[model samples]
Target chain A: MEPPDDAIPDRPARETLAHLRARIAPAEAASGPVLPLGAPPLDQRLPGGGLALGAPHEIAPEDVGDEAAALGFLLALLARRLAEGPGEALLVLAPGHPLPYGHGLLALGLDPGRLLFLEAGDDVEVFRALEAALQAGSLPAVAGLVAEGLPLVAGRRLQRAGAGTLLLILRPAGAGRPNGAATRWRIAAAPAARDGAANPRPRWRARLERCRNGRTGDWLMEWDGGAHRFDLPHGLAGRAPAAGGTPA
Target chain B: MPVALAAAGPGGLRLTAVDAGARALGLRPGEPLGRVRARVGSPLRILPAEPAADAAALERLCLWAQRYTPRVAPFGPGEDAFGLHLDVTGACHLHGGEAGLLDDLERRLAAGGIPARLALADTPGAAYALARFGAAARSHVPPGGTAAALAELPVAALRCDAATVIALKRLGLKRIGALARAPRAPLARRFGAALMMRLDQALGLRPEPLAPIPETARYGAARSFLDPVSRQETIVAVARALMGQIAPRLAAHGLGALALRLSLHRVDGAVKALDLGLASPGRCPDRVAGLLRLRLDRLGAALDAGFGFESIRLDVTAADRMPEAQGMLGAGPAEDGIADGTAALAEALGQRLGRPLLRLGGVASHLPERADRILPWRPGTGPAWSPAPLPPRPVLLLARSEPAEEVLALAPEGPPRRFRWRARLHRVAHAEGPERIAAEWWRADGPARDYYAVECEAGRRLWLYRSGPHAAERPAAWFVHGVFA
Candidate 1:
């Protein structure tokens, strides 16, 4: 008779909303600490003004050839985390994967002495070591390079085990499956800016493909090794580039 | 069938040992095999004697004999007979009494198909003499009766050489009783101090130390169960309890275990030993238990608990002096906390992976590949990370360089303008350097490598090098060594 007054709602609607919010409050609070990139634009875009620690993060190259770029991005993040504390970082390499050069890691502001390299026997062992290391919580950050995609159960386990540490999973491009990762990044090598110098700084087109509780965007990031910080190229300093465009 | 083992002797092939069938046929050791073959006029199984294998088996038996007493030594191949010496001074009570222990030892050895003569006595020398030439297979000599027990045995039973035995017999001192009654001065003067020393040792006059096998473990604890345990949890729990028993002894000695050995003694006398290596020397039972748990989990189905394990023993095979805990007055909690956590993690990972956690160490070498090495991670024991001013290195270095094909260069000695690597063609848009690195003169690693950092048009950077110099007879070979960010 009253045209099914569902739009007006009833007393139970308020209680349902409160219950949903109550369920989400503990999860948001349990995300643990935040590690800021020290860049205002990037940090502001993140939900907590930084990457959420104690959660799993997925990173993959945009193409097979861009693997080095993806690794560089992950190492940069690891370096930032190491700088924030006095603990070591572990890099677990799947079987048959090449090791990252020590001098290169040093150049990226990561101390080779502070990094532990564990070459796992297979993809399964890689995940096993990653989960164990994360649960140990002795390290500031743990990163693994796997050849296969992460299964859903493993992803959840990793998320659960990595409380109080940063967990990074690096896989090949297009190998990502549904997981509970807080953020998924796609990294691709970008052409160096022509600054009339013989050696230009390395650059990458880092795209935040997915963020669980934050907005996603794309940016051209330049690694300033001397300062140990990410910088925008000289020409694109203040302007926020348009989102969802082909990488230049 | 008659079975005899033959070994090459100075005169000819001689039998080293004989089985029961061969013995019944009147075949004896030290007899010529050819003579036996000609006289037997029947089929006899003659096998080559492996002295080395026999020694190894005897050594393993000595290790197995450790079940009875920690002080067990292998005696052999010399003037003395091949056998084991167990100093069961205080260990005799563990298996009832002396007679019971001897019985159990004989029964077990018999079950293993090993024909062994067991004896218990006050001294190792007396025990050896009784076991070798005694009338019974198993004999027990009462304390203070060593002289009486060894009296009936021949003088050769004192482990003297053949020449000494013959000399004594020529003097009509054939029996130990006769030798002991003879003039001590003449015997000591004629036969030297060794013969008298052996006699005195057997009579308990002189202390004869049994040089037990070099035990790897200094401290150990064992637990036996009435009902065998096969479940993984039970085994881990037993291992933890054993470790708990051993930790206090280790602490009492101010030692920490660097390596541990967990031996699961099955009901069938088979032992399954698992070794765990610690990253840092520690005596904490909980950490040891955690590592053992991980190791057992990794073993999973491979851990064959045949008829279950009746006893579990934990041994600290390798240990180091552990400093006493310093007062927490001036220590930083952050550093200590991290170090402890790291050590625990390393132990877990190491036990699970069956390898040690490694960290990269920089080496003072010009070769890129030889510049860094992965060494086992040890706290406060690696090179400090200092960034050296050097050329830009690649982020990922291939274990082996791959050859590049379809190379097109604008200049003969310049970087290639276009190249194909792994079946993919790449066009170089920007290039830097001919960073010439010469091979070490002391090394024979071919010619120098002129490395170039090339950025391909597809936005991928690569590290390429040309081996040797360009010549008319041999064109320089191009190789892709690494990838860059």
Candidate 2:
């Protein structure tokens, strides 16, 4: 009986995109990559069709000590992509952090006016505001510091809101996967590279540990103390590190 | 005849001068008085010009005409040829008819002992011409028929001086009718457009605008009675009539008044003003009347209604609109909770102690003493708070600090270990370092204070500071600057 055709191992649960696209206009369905995080290669695979579009991508946050550096680096990449396209705003919901140090974000080329810092008194209000912004289609991206289990249904609802919403959730390590999150990214601090000088400024690296549709590997990086940009660490390109480091 | 009232001297009785005999003796405005004396000899008591009395009479006339229309504008200064322009557009019908209204006005003027002539016409020029040149001589023009009536009057009707009239007479334009017949180009080129404009205005081809007099301010309404209304119920009825005028007008303009000025137009023409202010802008007449009654009760005389008020006018001098904002989807500060709390506190205090006794504290500049102030219940505005670097601030602020004495271990850089407030001694437990803040040195009398953040054993945190240097030549005193909770 042809080994029961319904049991084909490779078939999708359903043709989700064809039916969903029918509901959404073709113009919206054919939109290009989410504003690329100005990071190379990751933008090439998104079907909407850029970097992760519309929902919060879980970012395993570095501890409080590395908060400023990590946020600065993430914002710099986001600002660069936003600057390349028609202007987009990045709303940062700093529920309890020290204002994300406005000077640092401004130094990273994010126009101060475009960076909206809402002091949401608590974690719940901040998340509600984030979800509201996504549903209203008012925000292009919402970056928040989440440190708990996100309700699976809430995550899905936020993703289905609109197309260009990139919710970058900076969660702490071991918070587990953001329930129902499409793509998950982990940013960790790597050792500074050996410059010609004996003592170099402290530098850190970020790796895309578990991308949903792409291979998961560590991307060796270095941070410049001034001119705040990350570049390919010396020579490593398309090559994964031979050994894995301790989990952040 | 021009009857002049003159006060001869401080000791003399008022004298009346009759110019009737002089007019019978062929006297004009510019003719010398000696010739008038030669013609009419005795019984003509001549008094020098009494400019003040003449002006007072003209002002009284202006006030009287306000009973007919609010916009009665008096013409000329110094009591010379004092004419008033009353814009009786829709009001003519109220006094029966235009002719009836004019006759009534003339009778009232004569009764008031004012020698005045009036002309009712479509344009100001025609009216002026009819009043000065055509009154008691020519047929009066029908209302709104300015052209046919003013056609035969002389060109002098254009308000031109003697020189311009003489110039026009020399140009063969003795009659206004002759000039109205001439070609526009020749008329404009020969005499100038101003001459033609006045001609056109008198003939109804062009409009002449007249400014109205200022209306007596009556923010809320009240009706006068022939009988003095001491009854609260009657006063309330009049107040309701006023609110009927107020609420609809405010609603039409999307406004609500925060304060209302209710003036009772007394029978004797004296106004008694009652001012009422609310916790917030409001439109409900009953609520406004409730607030107004508190003030009206203090009037010196019972609201007299000798002859009911001739009119009532409501002016919205102060108002506000509840602004609509776009963002946020939740209900506002609960009306019953926050709104009622603020309103009740204000209303209770306002009703019991009278209006000006309670007020909100206002913040001013950083000059220590002037930083916080209390402004009375009046419309006062404060400067915007600019983001400037201020001294380490307390979480809670006090209106006026209580007097206290302090003892410090170190002279300049230490917190107080013991402080005496209101003659009671308290010991400090944990203390924060001296937050060095200097007085604004630009001022003449500046207090140099060294602030200290000290927590007492009783768990009270006080912002205590010492004024003047510890080792200064002058004595140092401790001031309990502020208390923080």
lDDT of each: 0.83, 0.55
Instruction: State the lDDT at B326 in candidate 1.
Output: 57
**lDDT for position B423 in model 1:** 93
Candidate 1 lDDT by residue in tens digits, B84-197: 898888998999888889889988999999988887888888888888899998888988888888888999889888999999999998899989999999889999999999
RMSD of each: 16.4, 25.6
lDDT of 2 at B355: 34
Docking class of 2: incorrect
What lDDT score is found at residue B224 in candidate 2?
A: 43
Winning candidate number (DockQ):
1
Instruction: List model 2 lDDT by residue over B435-479, tens digit each.
Output: 555645666564566776666664455667666566657446776
Writing each residue's lDDT as its tens digit, candidate 2 over A51-130 gives 56675566664443344345554565466545554433434343444433222233344443344444444555446556
Which stretches of model 2 miss by more than 4 angstroms?
A: A1-248, B1-57, B60-222, B226-228, B245-273, B278-284, B293-353, B356-368, B375-412, B472-475
Candidate maximizing lDDT: 1
lDDT score for residue B46 of model 1: 93
